[model samples]
Target: MPVFVKKVLAWGSLAFLIYFMAFRPEGAAQMFKAIGAALMMMAQGLGDFLTSLMT
Candidate 1:
């Protein structure tokens, strides 16, 4: 189980690295900014769904 978790984390990090390097290499600053924006949107959508279920 530990080994599986480690492999999953490693693969996930590697995927992020490859995606940022290959597809978004205009600049590190901008790449991180886009990632943050995407995460915020994802979080907001998730929160909205959860709140709707409660209400």
Candidate 2:
């Protein structure tokens, strides 16, 4: 991607995160928790798949 587009996306994401954190701290926490859970699940699934392939 172009530098301009990258900067725009970075700034936009930062602004959105700040807004979410300031205006809805609880919601932001919950969202982060959900994201963590999803990532954990994905990791576990990948591990299981790798184990199955080896066995």
Best by TM-score: 2
Off by over 4 Å in 1: 1-26
True lDDT of residue 45, candidate 1: 100
Candidate 2 versus the native: TM-score? 0.88
lDDT of each: 0.90, 1.00
List clashing residue pairs in candidate 1: none
Candidate 1: tens digits of C-alpha lDDT, residues 1-55: 6999999999999998888778778775687889999999999999999999999
lDDT of 2 by residue, 26-52 (tens): 999999999999999999999999999
Which numbered prediction scores highest in lDDT against the true structure?
Answer: 2
